[model samples]
Target: MDTNGMDRRQFIKVSAAATAAATAGVEGILAARQAPAFAQGTALGMLRWNDFVPASDELLKKTIIPEAEKALGAKITLETVNANDIQPRVTAAVQSKSGPDMIMTLNNWPQLYEESVVDVSDVAEELAKKQGGIYEQSRAVAQSGKKWLAVPWAIVGLTIAYRKSLFEEVGYSKFPETWEQYRDAGKKLKAKGFPIGQTLGHTFGDAPAFSYPYLWSWGGKEVEKDGKKVVLSSKETLESVKFMVAFWKEAHDEGGLAWDDSNNNRAFLSGTICATLNGASIYIESLRKPDQYKTAKGAQMRTDIAHAALPKGPAGQFAFHVPFSHMVMGYSKNQKAAKELLRYLGSKEVFDKWFVSQKGFAVGPTRDWEKHALWKEDAVMLPFKDAARLGRAPGYAGPAGKKAAEVLTKYIITDMYAKAVQGMSAEDAVKWAHGEIQKIYG
Candidate 1:
């Protein structure tokens, strides 16, 4: 995958460090790896994200479930849960060694529960070979310590969604293509009474999506390349902090300090802001509900809104592409049925149907799957066509494991930027973040 544009200042440094640290751990683990063969069972169970797009869940129930059951000669039951509840539910299930046979989760969670999850390297390899090749960033998140603990499912592409009319009103025919220009344009928009919005609160999705890309654009990283040392105290990071503080004052509202994942979506749709960084969900919502917008009905959203890959920085353009994954638990008695169900769903035919049902919001994991017609048909989605390749896991300068997950879950990086923007000194904020990160890595 071509994640060449995903890093600003320290791509080489972060990649090298994380690779060395992760490779050693993987080698030792794989040397002792042992896995059971596929033995079909009578039934299967999967825990999945409750569909934000209702049609998606409805279609899955009507199509994939019946097809998989028929193909595997087993009844597969799926339990849909909210995104926030997934970690606690999965953790409890893993602890009890009695729960669903498989589960869907965001980010590199399989790394955190590797010991309790069955190795699905076979399933992953089969899909990879069949699909030409899986994305490099996807592999990084799914593999850990030499085990394919989870199968790479899809990339939830993140990009900039903005009001085209608003930008053009300020002499910008298109969204700015660089950080400096983006900030300047934002300032202009702010003066025009429509500030750009970015959440600074502890939102799991939008918070990291915006903050990490900004940090990377400034050449700042959470940790050193070895994935052990905290590096947020560097000059590059301070520059990012200063930029964020000024940008927040001029471009964002105070309410953003407490906004959650849905806040920006609502804000953008309500005509409260000129732009925001988000997944296709925000843009999709605009199209799905043109009545909510200030523009007249019909082609209002399609004509007024557009997307851009995150603007380039002095280091280069960067963005966060979070990989969603699916895994089977080792303790499940129905592991064979679960694997069969995964295989059935992994087929291009099954996934393509689900992808369209969601209006192409779900990204295909590999390059070959790009043959789906969605990218060609929608201009808003075209920027995300290579998202699986041009994005990074949140744990950029570190291994995607328990420690990195902890830092992210606790909102360490988000809090750091939030504090700085809220008037905390840049040095003090970095110090606080460094201290917090040290507790995790150490």
Candidate 2:
């Protein structure tokens, strides 16, 4: 919390410059000069998710790849794909015992494919030491058993993005901080014809991200901390489902039942829903759109829509964050070159540049980077300042593993809530999901 040795004023200035750079389309701004070309002997192939943030991919192509090439004297062939597609590709690579030298993807894929991913303990430990140690969520995500299967990259923070003026119209000056308040607000807003939404469909982002946080907030967990037992059929879980049922009935439209990942973003931008839980992308994307949404008159859409922390439940407010990780494939012919490239990219100096380029859409795993300037100075980014520490990875109260990832990816939790809200008994829904989860854990 102490700025981690960053001078506050200096960081504020840096934040301003970063913002200016984003709007001005600054090219290679982080660089002071060019360097000698890479000696063409070693080649490393990498596969990673095509960044949702366009600037991130741009920086990778324009600056990061070039710099790493110059420093390591290696030719790095980078191929990026959609986040959803990374898993199948990684699985194919693992099955065939050959693929790109390194891969980066979302949420415990390293753990899912741990046997096929090289041990990156050296990279993990060394980077943690360099970056003031890894955050708890990072460690839980990237490590499997006793080995570090991957290096934790950045975490995408998930929180509630809502319309402030609408809340004010409902007599609340700020976003609700507790579930009781949220329900009340939802009812009032729905009465005013403004729906409150949490996706019940099979969305890559909205379904699990929001549901898991709500589950944890109500003290419901898929598995116990030991990670081998099913504990989802408890009172806590039923309570979470029942709460969701009530809220959905009072607030959301039937369309939310089938909504996918981009639906909420489109809904919010079009003023269809007044609130939803999502990453900073919802707000970041609004910055590029026209100021035509009438949610807040005379104010820009970016200014009217605000980010808020997850509302507290009976347990407390717990944020849900997905850990994106980087790993070297076990079958790669160029393991050494792969590790070297990760080391270069993971350094504070280089990562800081990339973080700035990302426009603060994500938080790195390091505790020290918590003091990064964008968090303190950017109004839209400030809500996520504590995400690295306060957040819990998916499958909380248990280690992230294949079972956990399976439960999450299959939309079990989302379906549980949806069934209950759509008039199925909460107990029956829990029983159905509990059985599905047990099959995975067994």
Candidate 3:
């Protein structure tokens, strides 16, 4: 499918057009229209992750929902849980055929539950056409063939947030640009009691965000481009695993094996770690309470924080920025109300408030948001503005479809490294993961 080349080219074209539109001062919210009316007492339920950006959740509860209800004439119920717990909830709901009418999903989950979810091509296509087209990474995960499986939501851009002063003290004036250099810097930092923090646990976010990109950068992938053959047991895969085992021992926080998405955020904020691959949440949280999260010198920690893309490997620099979407469950009787809610949420008039609340933690699904004025507010956030441009989905070198989603939900890639770090041989770990993937792809 040449997904990489196609997405890159399309993104460049869309981005340039969007930027030019912004330059011409064409930025504005979608024009107001008549609110869609529904039956009295029609209530729709939604499930989503407890946003890493608490302000967004607060805004949702305190403002957006009330406004949405007034506009849509449908009572809404919102439920949130840990990101790691969402998949289980989704599985249970789909099996029982009665649960939240709509669920917020991460990565390529739309592909994973394609048959169980209602097609929202009408909602998705309208939003994309109005919002300068959805980013390819977002589209790749939400769209399957000619149908849009879900409405593409915002993308959480992942970057390595580090303590700038700590790296400088270790004689690294700038963040390391290559994996080897990063490992060297991490080794020195760890000796100084500041290790790089990363998780290889069964997390839905940070674990695979690190694992998939790290694997791809070293030229390891789960399947071939045709998406039929398993190819994880390669020399490249083994070499990456071996390096990770040593890296974990010499440079990373050893306790990270038990950590989830929020652990590294807390570890970095607590000043126990120097760097970690995370969303802008860590930085945003520090900014929210400058006095609460201060350095030893009593300086605001946000001042000392900077973000960089993951280090480059032999293959190149890559990222797996988490793509989010809204899926309307097919089993729900409230499909009409759920689709209305999707349209309301996807509208810029509403989403802008949530986006601003994120403060660059989550960028829009479309290219136009890259032109948003928020990027100019903080230099540290600039890197994330274009992060999705380098994004590669799971099942890379193949379609990020059902099989890839299976591998992701099973944590195969993340566990491959976890196994190697926890005493398994690199070759054995790769072989084990390869066999697991073979079962799914076959």
lDDT for each of the candidates?
0.77, 0.79, 0.88
For 19-56, candidate 3 gives per-residue lDDT tens digits of: 44233211211222223434568899999999988889
Cα lDDT over the full model 3: 0.88
TM-score to true structure, per model: 0.88, 0.88, 0.91
- Clashing residue pairs, backbone N/CA/C < 3 A, model 2: none
Model 1 weakest lDDT span, ten residues long: 28-37
Looking at candidate 1, what is the lDDT of residue 207? 86
By lDDT, the candidates rank as 3, 2, 1
Instruction: List candidate 1 stretches off by more than 4 Å.
Output: 1-41, 296-299
Backbone clashes in model 3? 0
1 versus 3: better lDDT goes to: 3
Tell me model 2's lDDT, rounded to 2 decimals.
0.79
Candidate 2 Cα misplacement greater than 4 A, ranges: 1-40, 290-298
lDDT of 2 by residue, 261-321 (tens): 6788888887877898888888888776656554545667787778888889998878768
